[model samples]
Target chain A: MPEEVILQAQRELPDWDGQGFSLLETPFSGVKFKRLLGRTRDTLRELLKIPDHFHILFMHGGASAQFSLVPLNLLGDSKCAAYVDSGYWSRKAIHEAHRYCQVEHAAIAEDYIHTSTNTAYCHITSNETADGLQLSLALKASTPLIVDMTSDFLVRPIDFEPIGLIYAGAQKNIGPAGLTIVIVRDDLLGRAHALTPTVLNYTYQVEAGSLVNTPLTYSIYLANLVFQWIGHQGGITSMAKRSQTRSAMIYDVIDASEGFYRCDIPPDQRSRMNLCFKLPDEPLTQLFIDHAAWSGLVNLKGHVQKGGIRASLYNAMPDAGVVALADFMHRFRKQYADL
Target chain B: MPEEVILQAQRELPDWDGQGFSLLETPFSGVKFKRLLGRTRDTLRELLKIPDHFHILFMHGGASAQFSLVPLNLLGDSKCAAYVDSGYWSRKAIHEAHRYCQVEHAAIAEDYIHTSTNTAYCHITSNETADGLQLSLALKASTPLIVDMTSDFLVRPIDFEPIGLIYAGAQKNIGPAGLTIVIVRDDLLGRAHALTPTVLNYTYQVEAGSLVNTPLTYSIYLANLVFQWIGHQGGITSMAKRSQTRSAMIYDVIDASEGFYRCDIPPDQRSRMNLCFKLPDEPLTQLFIDHAAWSGLVNLKGHVQKGGIRASLYNAMPDAGVVALADFMHRFRKQYADL
Candidate 1:
């Protein structure tokens, strides 16, 4: 939520392109809106360095929908797909994929097992927001890899070659909720199961120019602006450096806290985007969350299922913001050590 | 597109409820976000007079998704469903439904016919934007009726009886693109085909609080604002009256043109939301479109298949806008008399 993007949306809300109508008022199929869509796609392709062989689709229903859609689209004649059960999101994706195909766990939680070579595709949550786990970029598989990059997309450089598809919900690093970005290799387009919902059919969406239905026009517009912001911030290279710097500050606090603060994720597997940790006890954890909130570091509470503390350091998070949180965590640990 | 609603969204964009984060930055499952969803549902329920027995779902993928979802959700063990071929949208619905079940044309375009009583349900487009056709509110059927009110929902009072489901894409009168509102009777739940996509499943959407995935948060917010705006504009009662007046002005002008313009839809079946008409020839039609654009009556060109002019007078359309279009049409016809 860059101030520039929000302000631009506000200014355009009254009349888009001086058309005496809101950008939301533009018809999804109209030339003006089509231009917006095309510009967004072009800009994103440039920023992400997406290969020409990839088809970028702007879809709805978030990554949760992609959890089901990926299997429906790629499982074609294969009855089994391999999935890495890295964390919360990966487990959810695995559960949904079971409806359409058999899901074999390639890697469960912290284990780094490989997928069976005969599987349709290997699925992985590149970064798990809730559990603070992430797959290394150098990780490879025998089967085509489908990555749920929801928490880490565009935050660093990506190698497109071992990947069949990469999908991310836009709420985190991309733009906003309600829009999902899917980058699928062109060869994977026509393999969807016949029963797949037309809206979720990648081929159908590509054919319809992502105007398969009325798209999230405003969300796409905001994403376009966010993409512009990323371009302004020196693209993924700068974002990666910033992300490492921010996450390290907080991880440094946890590592130095001895027994007072703990992060369960293996250091090598920890997510750069989300840092999850725990205090010595539940009450202390609650106190940490309240203190963080009072100090203007909100949404610091852990996801209810995995209670402790979790801080999301998304692309929009300023370096100073993380520095402040790291400082707060250090002060809290010292204050509570005597308790 | 209301200025007040847009401004409110802009103000709230930077920080919602003093949470020190953009509204878009709030977690989908967070308490604040859930409250926003609940308030929007309640406000919409109150405004639309939705009964307790009906489930109100704010979904994505727009009305086109519903074209497929209606059959996948309602057709059940019955392989046949009756659909009225009212106009462009109805035909599209029928075509999409064929992928899931056998479609019987209950009423072909230009005909009013009854569906077989044994069919799963009868479907109709309440208002056809391209052809300017609408089903009368008094129409009844032995089987339950599912209406695609994409172009006219909330523009007038609707009868609940005999209708099992009513769905509309929000871009017209409700809010913006990317969100679809589905009102389904409780009994229709749990009847979806086993192969139905989870995101489009009525039961799944309900169970997940319409959060089967990260919903179009901003779109829902805008829809909530539009709902408030509807209330401010004296509710649907006022809207219906305004719609009638605006449409009548345009229709009157067409009627008085005496061969200069023609509307093929039967007068009684003509849509109050979309008024489609043709001039004497293609050149005249093109001239009319060019002239309309010059007069600031944009998006007046009809659907390519229809090849004429279409003026959409949705609920948000001011009576003055329609009057101006009518005035422009009158003057255009006078200038082009020699042609």
Candidate 2:
């Protein structure tokens, strides 16, 4: 979603790297496609510092698909899995896992979250986009820790030492929406249930080198561009710092408003990717959103279920945009506080 | 894949339709995205002449994913489904369906293909890409006819009266690889298995208007462009005629080669989309492919399982390409006849 990435993609749209054809026109086995696949995998590995024991797979169907695939692939003879009830996405994962195996709702605050020795894995939605909550607690689980880092994947550096698998939908911090990145430990490859579809089978995908079927070729190409852009922008450490600065700018305005605006999330649990807040009344909230749109700051509406305002500050959001939003929030609060 | 379509896409890559955001940057619920979704669905319906009783749902994953979903969504209370084993892709669909329900292999040549009154559906892969075989028979089935029209979709007009559902991966004729289009009858919406993943559930997807989870934003946008392009190119009627003319130009050389070239598929079953043929020997076949590549005709190598040359003439292929290929084939045959 970076401007440089989008520009590069547009420039190479008609003909990719002078290959005489677009990326979609070339066969997956061709040189251009092979280079794309290899470079994307390598770049992701270099960026994430993923262990050699882990296989990075480019898959389809986004994070929602992984809700079923995680339980199917990891529930090898185990009858149950432990899941942390973080928020919206975590509840969706737990609900989907119930269709495959027993889901034990556990909290990450526990000293050792794994309830039984035979539990399949410990799952958590590391960042909940809907509720603007993120997990910052150190996971103390004995079983494999599976994290859905959909909204906050590359916003910060990851420590793969305590992780078994990580899946992220690429719309937020990575690239686009159609592709899902699954980094799974090699040892957990062939544990899929018999009824698992081959497209969702981890072992088959790894064996086929993630070319089990024609992949989301365009998304992967753009994602590689994004990864390169990230590397150029000083990698995940820089992205994390920017995220903190951007979210704090908006959160500071809410904290200083003195009942003019409010954010209910605890400071420890607030998501740096998506910051949700509310104004005093529905009419004032509407006015704030309308005024923001008039000032060329769009898509500030919150998730419909929550119904207030959300400022999603992904990696692509420039710092100037956040500064503008903070400025707008201050002016809007001054105008509405006297009402 | 059309040059005009690609150029249009490239032109609008940075900012789509003056919305000041790329297609991937817009939220699914936003006005730009909703317009895209509606226009795409409408254009496809107009092109395919899809009935009012059918709901056109844009989905994730490709044809291979649908091999499992078709059965999962339509199996209902029926324990058996009839599948026609034509070739590679059909066998794949049949194999995947076996994991879910009882698969009854029935040929289209049968007078009444459905063996039981309670059979869920009759499935078929309309065109076999690997072997250049296609089903030309008018199917007679008491049950709903579910067709995997992945390769041949939009190449010809379809009769929807006898069909219950049709699904196609959009890469072939529609757009890119990540999005699949599922057109299901209104009556078959709620028949998915209890454990079916929500992403694969037809009822859930329809109710959510294919925004169930992001819905492959970029592919849908490109697919809309392709639909408009198809409309400009005189719709499916023009595509079918061009397919015949283009394939006949290649197949004529094979038939006239006497013993120098051979296409094993029966004349009636030979596909108009993919035309496969073999040279006298492996060396000659290798020479032909290399020469064709040098002449700027690439990707003529056949499937590895079926080692020969396959000329896949999709909708995007210009007639000039076929003319060049036919001319090259004639010259190559004249030169290699002495060998």
The model with the greatest lDDT is: 2
TM-score of each: 0.97, 0.97
DockQ of 1: 0.65
DockQ value for model 2? 0.76
lDDT of 2 by residue, B240-318 (tens): 8999989998999999999788999999889999998899899999999999999999989998899999999999988
In model 2 chain B, the worst 10-residue window by lDDT is B107-116
CA error at residue B54 for candidate 1, angstroms? 0.4
Question: Which 10-residue window of candidate 2 chain A scores lowest in summed lDDT?
Answer: A107-116
- Computed on alpha carbons, the lDDT of every model, listed in order, comes to 0.85, 0.88
In TM-score terms, candidate 1 sits at 0.97
In model 2, what are the clashing residue pairs, if there are any? none
Cα RMSDs, all models: 2.0, 1.7
Please report how far candidate 2 places residue A304 from its true position, in Å.
0.6
Top candidate when judged by DockQ against the true structure: 2
Model 1, residue A79: C-alpha shift (Å): 1.0
**Candidate 1 lDDT over residue span A222-334, tens digit each:** 89999999999999899999999889888999999887889988898888998998889988988888888788888888888998888999888877888899899879978
Off by over 4 Å in 2: A110-114, B110-118
